[model samples]
Target chain A: MIVTVTPNPSVDEIYWVDRLKIGKETQEEYLTRATDSDISAGGKGINISIFLARMGLENIAMGFVGGYTGHVVVRALRDEGVTTNFVWMGSGETRINLTVLEHGREHIPILIDGPGIAVAEGEMNRFMRRYRRMLKVADWVVLAGSLPPQVNLAFYYELAKLAKQAGVKVAISAGASCLTHCLPAAPNIVKPDTREHLSFEWMKLGTKEEIISAGKRIVQDGVEIMIVSHEVTGDIVITRDSIWEINARVQTTQFRNLVGADDALLGGVIYQIYNGAGIEQALRFGLAAGIVSAESREKVCRDMGKIEREMANVTLNRI
Target chain B: MKVGEIMTRDVTSVEKDIPVKELIFILDSAKMSNMPVVDEEGKLIAFISEKDIIKAALPGYFEMLHSTSFIPDMNQFAKKLGQIADDPVERHMHSDVICVEVDDDDLQAADLIIRKNLKSLPVIDAERRLVGVVKRIDLLHHLL
Candidate 1:
């Protein structure tokens, strides 16, 4: 079983509008055509769950959720048949990420910082107990995305350690502090997107050699697989033994949505790894999911068959 | 004719490890006597009902009392169950639930519900992951 942890998930409100041009009406209102609006659950871990399920893999999404919107997010995942184990907060509500995408235009995303998490000492203890229990059932455990303000980023480090101790493979998709702390814990897989890698002071990933060196540094820290994806240059998968560059077969579609494609990439890799595929094949599958996700309006992947067909274009070269 | 065509897609369910106390709100608000307990894949691991909650909660009293007596207000009994709110429903839920596949005939689902005296039946896939639910009322609304 693949178990995922999302600390700060959200309910997203996506509005499809004609244009982004502001009118004199407060300059703050982005009017939606009522029928052009959709709401879905967001967060890296939840996206992983959706992508895995679409690929016919079983996954569980767990983390902290609260308030009315939390219920909505939970129900949405359940409706998608992704099992959830979110711990409810007593007071604060989950955040809502409002996105405005005009036809044939770039999306403007305004993210509201959701409820401030002040997990009581007792609550932390209880949540940890439950988290450990979940790790036991996992063949692979995924720690993904940003954490709530009140949470210590070291929590991921502890979780990775626990999963390793339990003999479960660990994959991490977080950035900055969480990644920094967990790197020494040496998860089996570390998938960090462009922005996340750019956050590092030493990571000047402009050249191909620089990016490969950066990935090697991470692998040397004990991570078995380090995957860094760039929208323009494609994906690089680095391991202790070898480095593989996988090409993305991105097709031009009038309708496009770019968000969460990287998460889908990680999802594909995990799905392949769960099925015991080799590193080269896994990277190709990962790129296939990313390419298909760009063609979908929803952040999650929609077409598994299309992804499979596109896999042929995902050429891999051992560098 | 298939269960997928008529089964309610928005089915309410609970996780196996959830506290039985949590069911009070879901069961009471939804007016549901029972709900399926699902695992990570949305597979039907078990089913929990009001009777299961009460049975799991009243174990202490059952062992203490030997003689039969008149019952008090139902609310009082519920109040007593609240004391063991931390107890997991996994201890009480029916693990071996009779479920219908989504592609199964609606007649087969209705007949199973009747034969087994079930309130509703879980609609699953070939993998046994829950897909929907077919309540008795759904059958009534369709046939009658």
Candidate 2:
């Protein structure tokens, strides 16, 4: 079974509108009705758990949740057949994230930040106890998303160390200090979340060569697989034995929503690797799943046949 | 109310290739009379119920008609079950399953359940994926 941890979960609300008006100078009331809207559980690990469960994989989701929004997250995960083991906070509610998609301009979505959460000492201890127990039966553990407020930057590092000691493979998808601090544990797979930044550990990822060098640096530090986004349509995968570049033959115009595509890619790769696929084949399937998610109206595509059909459009070249 | 509003979203389903023994265990443990059979993409393709298992264990209609004096004993049922225990549930499941969609009226689901004598109806989406299940008990409880 797979175990996933999301430090801070959210209730993601997405609205689709024909057009959005901004910076109006006239003193008039304007109303923009949404064409459609949807709400679901949101967080990096939560998204991965949903994706894995859709594929009929047995996975348990662990995190901190509270209030009405927390119940929404648990219900959403339960509906998808994901076992949730969330620690309820004592004082605050889970945050809500909003995404606005405009017609004919879905390539660029408007994302709104949600409120941050502060984890108390008791809550942190409770989560750690549950996490350690889950690792005993988990074949793989994924630590993803940003750290909550008042949480240490090395939290992922501590979790990764515990997982490694239990002989569970670790896959981390995080950004900034949270990503860099876990390097000492030598996670099996690392996919640096590059949505907020285009560099890794002070190294720029502006070109293919630069990405390859940065990825190799991480692999040299004992990470089995290191994936870095090179562009919107391509990614670079580096390992101890070889380096490969994967590209999806998809147009920007075909994208309907790109919010959860990255999470799907990581989930897809882990799913394949857990099922005994080679690294090259796993990366190819991951890219196909990512492309399918990007082209769908849903945040993450749950159709396995659609992903299989799109695999022909993904190409992998050894660098 | 729409089917989506009142349906039980946490559905327990199995794939097409599960063994009959495992299927029976799941049904007994979950206390469910029937279970939907989905494909790899989670689309509802068939359904299997406790009635189907009993039918499989019983003698054929022609055989029973041939010998009206013959009564089905535990030995007969056990032998029949043993023959198919290792077989996949797909061999005996009903491929033409009756289902409702999420946006359908709850009255429509009630009509189907009462008319068809079903314990529950699988609720699907536009893509025919199994999203939830609407049970007859749930419909009656909603009335109160």
Candidate 3:
């Protein structure tokens, strides 16, 4: 079974529109939407769990939630057949991120910060306590998304270290603060997007070679698997012995939602690994899962059959 | 909604070896009447409550009479409270503790708390490790 930790999760409200324009003063130019809207539970780890559960994997989603909105997030995950053990640790409602996606236009996202999580100290302890117990049953633990205001880099570092001590595999897709700290703990896998790699001076450009060598050095420092997912050049997966590049060909329609694709990719990798598949197979399977979600314009992959069919289109080159 | 949906996740717990004096300070500081006790590996083994401490502090005659009328002096009560300084939490804690799972329904949790007369229901995952707690107040807060 897999366990995912999303420190800060939210209820995302996506609005579809033909055109979206922001006006300085209550004007008619901004009055565009009437097409459709949907709300879903969100957070990088929760998204990954959605894909993992869709792949017939047993997994649990854990995080901090509060107020009525928090309840909605939990209910959303539960309704989707995703087991949840989220901690009701703080006061106030969880955040709701509003996204306006216009046809043939840029996606406009207005994010709201969540509740301050008043008892940050106590909740951090509670989260770790729960995480340790869950790690006992977990084959892979994915730590993803932004940390809540109170949860800092040290928390993720401690969690990754705890998971390692339990002999559980860990795949982390977090931001600079958490990811940089976790690298020293040597997570089983680290998936930092191309933009995140720019933070490191050596990986400023984020080229395929630069990222691969950096991923290799991370292996030397203790990371077992390093995956640098680039927006333009595609994904590069590396281990100490070999480098694998799996970028599948899939036709994306005019409407697309890239919000959950990264999580889908990591979920696919974890899914293949949990089933005892080799790196080559895992990469191919992971890329296909990513494509399946990206092309569907949904936060989760609704069809495992489609991913399986697209598996043949995935190209894994050894470098 | 399940008991877990409204449970307080930041539970204050004490280890078995915790000194009673320190335990008292913990409970007082947290304004709590009872807390769950866990072993080194963090499995719920017992529970300690204000009632247990009072029981431990009471004179032996009180047990036979089941009454506190004999202790007529307020000074005697102060002396009885001092008895808590000696033993560790494990020595005074109730060995049998009941816990609820995260998936348990709110109604079942309410029933357990009512039947057992628990101030707070300790919530545990499948592994029997403490996760959070559902306090009596938490339930009342929601119901009222």
Candidate 4:
């Protein structure tokens, strides 16, 4: 069974206000009445696991959850019929991130960083030991998204190495720090967005060609698959065996929030891989998942049947 | 008729520091779907409906004296109330209060009752103080 590990899982609360006023207090000059709020459990891997569960995939989601917020996240998962095997940390609640949007159209979002959790080193070791034990039972161990400050970026690389040694295929979906550290070690697959691609160049020493060259060079560095998602450009590149260029399908109508698109992509990739689809097919699945997210008002893309139907309409080219 | 003429001044509210358990008691006693959570200055801050309180307390909560006969933690429930209540009412309260000014037509309040899908709308003064609440039942009385 596929195993998804989310290091920093959160209860994502998305809400809408007719007019969101920030910094200054807004008084009702006698007008608007109420706002709408919808909440869900979200984190990259948790999201991926939810989508996988929706598709009737057999997998267990493992992660860190503590305090009251953890309880909410678990309840949310159970409500969706997804199985979770989370380790409860001693101190602090699981983080709650609020994605606040004003009305239906405004693109601006107010994201709360949430409260931090405090864990002792011993507690960390205990969690790691439990994770290792769980990993031993997993068929494909997928490490997705950022970890809480309790663990280092190296911890992810080390965990991937451990999984690799145990013959568990390791897939990492991360940005900046963890991506930089893990690239050299080379996990089975690394998915980076275009924003991440440009950020590394701006932050570190590199040009556009240099970064593409570096991404290309990593094929020799032991990474089996490199998926570069250019979201704004609506295309994804699968650099393995040969370069495969896949474009996102155009939306039939107006789209909603862009949140959880990447996680859906990852879910599509994992689903394809688990079903024994080749790399090219898996890449197309990932692209379709990302594109389908725009079709729904909620942005979580709950309908896999719709996604598959939409994917058929999307064309894939081998470059 | 004026908004104040039709509004109910006998309104019930909870303090900023009242525990969630006590709020549950108030909710149970008031038989209210929603409460106008107010501050010491009597300004409407936030509101906690039965639904909001239940969603917060039910998930992952344990009762210490579930089997005991003694007055179970009213505060156990109140602790949740306190958690929600401890914050400033302004922080969580619906600041966009659908209010009718002092001299507005009573018909406007009736429209608000139907359009906003609110059981009641707090009628306020120029300073935004809670003057009275016009319930749907009261508006129905006017219609009758």
Q: Highest DockQ among the candidates is held by which one?
A: 1
Error of 3 at B17 (Å): 10
Off by over 4 Å in 3: A23-29, A105-119, A195-197, B1-144
**What are the lDDT scores of the predictions, listed in order?**
0.76, 0.85, 0.75, 0.67
Task: Give the CAPRI rating of model 2.
Answer: incorrect
lDDT of 4 by residue, A83-189 (tens): 55566666678888777666555333566757446556854654566466556556787788767875777877888888887788878887766776777567888
By lDDT, is 1 or 3 better? 1
Task: Count backbone overlaps in model 3.
Answer: 0
Which residue ranges in model 4 land beyond 4 Å of their true spot?
A23-35, A102-110, A193-198, A201-211, A251-253, B1-144
Candidate 3 residue A177 C-alpha distance from true site, Å: 4.0
Using DockQ as the yardstick, the better of models 1 and 3 is: 1
- Candidates, DockQ: 0.11, 0.04, 0.07, 0.01
List ranges where model 1 is wrong by over 4 Å. Answer: A22-35, A107-126, A193-197, A201-210, A249-255, B1-144
Ordered by TM-score, highest first, the candidates read: 1, 3, 2, 4
Q: Which residue pairs in candidate 4 have backbone atoms (N, alpha carbon, C) closer than 3 angstroms, thus clashing?
A: B19-B82, B20-B77, B20-B78, B20-B81, B20-B82, B21-B77, B21-B78, B45-B93, B46-B93
Q: What tens-digit string does per-residue lDDT give for candidate 2 at A200-304? A: 566877788988887788889989999887777789999999999899988878888878889999999999999999998899888888888888888788999
Candidate 3 - chain A - TM: 0.90
lDDT of 3 by residue, A11-70 (tens): 887776776556565555455744877788888899998888777776788888777787
Q: Against the true structure, candidate 3 has what lDDT? A: 0.75
With a 3 Å backbone cut-off (N, CA, C), the pairs that clash in candidate 3 are none
iRMSD values, candidates in order? 6.4, 11.3, 8.1, 22.3
The candidate with the higher TM-score, 1 or 4, is: 1
